[model samples]
Target: MRLCGGHSGLLLLLLLLLTSEFPPGWSELFGWRDKKVLNVECETTGYEIVGDDFLVLCPGHCVGQQPLVWGSGVYASISSVCGAAIHSGVLSDSNGGMVRVSKKAGMRGYVSKFANGLRSISLPKWSRSFVFPEASRSMAESSQQWEQESIVSTGDKVDGRRLSFEAYRKGFLSSEAKPAAKDVSSPKGPNPFQQYIGRNLGTASRKPMTTTVSPKKMNKDCNVDIAFLIEGSWSLGVRRFESQKRFVTKVVEELQKTTDGAAVGLIQFGHETKTEISLNKFPTLQGVTLAMRKVSPIGGTSNAGRAIDEVAESFFQKSAGNRREAPNAAVLLLDGWPNDDLEVPARVARETGINIFIVMVEGATSEELASGVHGDFVNKSVCRPNGHFSLHTDRWTASSALVSPLVSRICNTERLICSKTCLNSADIVFVVDGSSSVGLENFPALLEFVANVTGHFEIARAGTHIGIVQYTYEQRTEVELGRHTTPEGVREAVRRVHYWSGGTSTGAAITYTRREMFAHSRSGKRRLLVLITDGRSYDDVREPAAAARKEGIILYAVGIAWAIKDELDAVANDPKSEHVFFVSDFNDLKTVGPKLVENICKEYNALPRN
Candidate 1:
């Protein structure tokens, strides 16, 4: 069964009535890594004990505490309640009213709700908001565009603003900040586009609507490597920026508790991508949380593609600390649609063997967010059975509540299943036209296109095997099926084959591919042939293509510049669009790389795993 849940207006209490401790995996799931008594450093004005639940009320500051609010999940404060209160009630000092507690079967604790009687309390002047050191360095140092727009925290700027801790506390405590102007709300409620417009035009501070809280379960599997890619763009705003940091901190807290633990990394990206914490940076959970709390948002455009590329190229590499044996993953917390297309880079990242989970807020449309998910894995696997991988929150603060559920999902990595040989179990052959038309200059482009297609598959004796056949006046088998045992080997061999530069004999190539490459593989793997050409064949291709199809070879015919559409159609597999492709020029071949890889992967996914 799929393991998933959502953040709602109720706290999830893990009851340990007898031991006065959490259930297995509870401490990790709830971000309860710090075992020391949280020094809220405030006077306990009142105390109540019901069963094993001990609720202590404090009058002032709580330094490091996770409070259980009636309608919210845990909040950072020792001033509220210090321990995990599985059973208890809160009494209003100003007014007396009934506090509703609803119990659900199989739930460890009850949902606590006050009847609109709990009022906001006034604070003393002596209480000042203490500023923590900035968590992460600026990410805009490398990008001129980002540097121009970045709101750098300099000279007494704790979090890009000179605000007392009292103000920061009040900002989060206030149920509703200055009623959003009538101009900001629509008949349907608050306008979603308000954040973008208000940010760019410098409108009045539109505080994110105070959100309700919620809760989750626990998972202990530690054989996973996760990297968090967060958007630190200006659009996230200062409050949201801090909220994102908190969410990340909680995830780190939870993941660090497993045996061996999940190796975690952090990447913050705006107009540029910055690696805030490398996967191997901090070996312990305490070190990870401490680093996370210091990360500040470096405002700029959200360029998720570049950030994805950075993770794919660097973060997961062995030299960069990624464990080759673990399942590699990236939890992308995106705020908006990237400035560039994510399809290619994301596909490349997936091809590199890292699973991607995209968490989009209000910034991008569903279609845009879905586009970045590797292999539509969000809909197919991550969100399988029920939950959604693309998490959408009403506002940024609410995103913090997602930490528990997100951790739960990630820890239950076993459930995030995929076919073992999803890209393996395939015998793929490429038929290329290396005539004078595709001169030495354009031939490499054709070869590069073939290389691009070859790069996405797993190349090994027992996995997907690759072969290449070049055709002109004479068809020559360049690489036999299952010959190259690695993608690097296949690519280097393809790159080394000098252009034949002869007459076009496409039919002969098809006949040669069937006779030389198709039947040699007795592996029962899916047979796929990609036929690429720039001109019509000197001989008929129909019979040769038919013979290959009769042998159950899935043919994909790609036509460039001078290649005839009719001949291309006759040569490709039935259901034309799925198998036939036409490109205007050899240079434009790179544009179709993602689509070709995706189609091939789709077919791979359809088959059973080896």
Candidate 2:
């Protein structure tokens, strides 16, 4: 029979009193029970309790189990019904209370901790668990008391001390029943209670009750134009399609909260591609979310490639609210394999300087994602290679967790910088000094620096072209312009450059790069020559450096160790601070690559478009 409210508790008490026999002193032991009997409505929603202590009837399944309790210094081993209630943190050991208990799906991990005077070990992920609507006020007060006394004196023999159940209960009760003054003295080592709590709670201290906090607003300085291309195919039913909309709404809500704000648009694709929200359609967060909610899924075959082309050709146009000055990005959410080709359209989109991020769910495979990205799908999408850009989830329910991470990636300013500059269309040649002074031990680091810088550009024959010239007493072209078009290809070629040892000939390397390497450079593309050396050149660099500049070569000089400042200044272009860089050791070259890329992009952006 279903039961609820104060009436249910009173009736249960009367029935128990009439039908049950009491042990010796049981009446006196439970004198406080006169206030409220156990409520039998374990399924009631929003059950309320007075003060702290009460009783709750457990669901039928929990009848034989030991009560699972967590919190510091709390103990409750009554009938399974009351014990499970206490274990769920609904009832405090101080007085007692009644609460409704509900079953929930098992968690990946459960944190066990002290509740009142009792503690429980962590349950495995597969173990069944129960939850209640709200914790009792007395439980909260008891938890506050525990947090205040979590740290004990260093002299306490808490380390590796195992007490029997009775002994441990007595010690815990005594410690909480009588409070000690706060010990402000510095701890000699880690506190034993803190360590114990950390072990059981899976954290350093008793986790404070989580309060609802507002989401973090996006950075105000980040400005970019983003297009979301979502597939609404028949495989994704209405519910999962709504999940995609909700995810996009959440991201747009956060993006619009910024001062500068990211301009976002949405395109829905199935059998055909349709622009659901134009970039200029919504001016406020509320408008964006409302518009997103109004969009209905058009279930058909997935045509992700067509949607990608739509975003590239139409969504980013000035008439559709594309900000020409801001970096462009397209996020494609695919639920299944595409009906058409992804590589050609994705490549075309990227060629227009739009960064493509692919989110694959359920039926979509990593191979499909790689085809859509058409570049470093794993690494280039985000700053680090954890596959942030190409996200995947096995189930629709878990897609909500991807929201914050996806928004952060889309708003990352550093990753967007290259899209705003002509770095993709520039011809870059690295001039290295493989002289005797630059020990062989340091040569790999120099190559690594070059690879790191090369990673920043979109390496392609029709895009940016990279060449390498290594010199000592003589010069040898390591990689000619347009020889390696892919980032991996360029990196591999850089790794294969054999170290040459002799006198420094920075000027001859510069002259050779201008005459040979720059000859392969395409017309209308910016010509950049990056010079790396550790010592002053044995031959004069001023004349050849000036000659290269006269021939329309932009020079950057990176000096390491004993390299002279005047030579670097002579080799580099004007504005020495931007064109010249120095580090004390070869290892520090890693830090200089990004700064150099930023400068390269800055110069490229400052120039008029061809």
lDDT of each: 0.55, 0.61
Model 2, position 129: C-alpha lDDT score: 32
TM-score of each: 0.36, 0.37
Residue 67, candidate 2: C-alpha displacement in angstroms? 49
Error of 2 at 421 (Å): 3.2
User: Model 1: what TM-score?
Assistant: 0.36
Tens-place lDDT digits, model 1, residues 438-528:
8887888988888877765656544578999998999888888877877678988987887888899999989988998887964457788
Q: TM-score of model 2 relative to the true fold? A: 0.37
Best by lDDT: 2
For candidate 2, give the lDDT.
0.61
Candidate 2 C-alpha error for residue 500, in Å: 0.8
**Candidate 1, lDDT over the whole model:** 0.55
